[model samples]
Target: MATTGITPSQDDRSVAELVRQFSEQTSHLIRDEMRLAQAEMSRKAKHAGAGMGLFGGAGLLAFFGVGALVTCAIAALSLELEVWAAALIVAGALFLLAGVVAMLGRGQTKQASPKPERTVENVKRDVGELKERHR
Candidate 1:
């Protein structure tokens, strides 16, 4: 029979020795699994961070694009009126749109309550039921 010195023959090992070996192997396996999970989460977080940065860059570019389009609008309006008048008209319209949006947003904000009303009510009901059960 050929014996590899790397490991003991299981058949010759006492039960207590085998149990100790099993406990060590299980602990090692759990530690390895934990390390793998940590590595995977780190990799995912890096990818998500990169994705968020790209999204921010995209939003900036889109904002610049909108500025260009607004400039084009002013240029088109200038053909029918003085350049100063065209610019003022566009600026005024933008302010008017902003005002309308702000008013709408204010109305929406007023309707939004800080409390989680439904959840609170449910919890109160649950507590009442629990008290009744105890009695």
Candidate 2:
């Protein structure tokens, strides 16, 4: 059989070429998507790092500020009471502050509940289904 037009072999070649081109284009698209994702992740990571650094700096500042206040209190007490009594008084005050802070934190935690109603219902439904299945 002699074919003058595009034969089966020619059609196959064309289809293979088209598939190859499509594969190459798809590969390029995937690479571009990966690059975009990497860039976005790097940007977000930089932002998170900067935020953490700012929080650490704030914590350091607060620590030093409290130390300075305690030193001032000790000095003020020294002028009125005996040195040991002044130290004891400052220590007692610090303990009281710690106790109050702990109590406030506990109260806040007790008041805070972030339960999801939908999730609870879904869990209950699943449990009921499981119990029915077992029965």
Candidate 3:
């Protein structure tokens, strides 16, 4: 047949040549898939890292905010109570608030999974396709 884009049938290709082509194409496919997985994982890792950084920043800012609030409250209350007593009460309350904020940030950081779930799923699908072709 003189078809413009038709491929030669199996009879036209030697077994060794077919094997070699198959091997080369399979290797290329695996490499391409790995590269894709790596890129996807990199993107996922970056998001996870950003989440952790934000959590850390929030915790730090919360502590600073609590300290500032405690200072302001202590100053205001010192008109009635002695300075040390007012400072102690404000410090204890503010510290509890700071602790709660820190815990919440920790929980959020823990929620961000580092796994590249999408990449794993794609690889699994590729493997399933290959198995189908084999059969």
Q: lDDT for each of the candidates?
A: 0.95, 0.93, 0.92
The residue-level lDDT of candidate 2 at 128 comes to 100
After superposition, the stretches of candidate 2 with alpha carbons farther than 4 Å from their true spots are: 1-31, 111-118, 122-135
> Which pairs of residues collide in candidate 2?
none
Q: Can you write out model 3's per-residue Cα lDDT over 1-135, one digit (the tens) per residue?
A: 566674667468888998999999999999999999999999999999999999999999999997788788998999899999999988888689889999999999998889988899999999999999999
Candidate 2 lDDT (Cα, 0 to 1):
0.93
Which stretch of 10 consecutive residues in model 3 shows the poorest summed lDDT?
A: 1-10
* Model 1 Cα lDDT, one tens digit per residue, 1-135: 876765655468888998999999999999999999999999999999999999999999999998998899899999999999999999999999999999999999999999999999999999999999999
Could you tell me how far off, in angstroms, the CA of residue 109 lies in candidate 1 after the best superposition? Answer: 2.3
TM-score for predicted model 1 compared with the true structure: 0.72
What ranges in model 3 sit over 4 Å off?
A: 1-10, 92-135
**Model 2 Cα lDDT, one tens digit per residue, 16-125:** 78999999999999999999999999999999999999999999999999999998898899999988888899999999999999999999998877997789999999
Candidate 1 — which residues are off by over 4 angstroms? 1-34
| Candidate no. 3 TM-score | 0.52
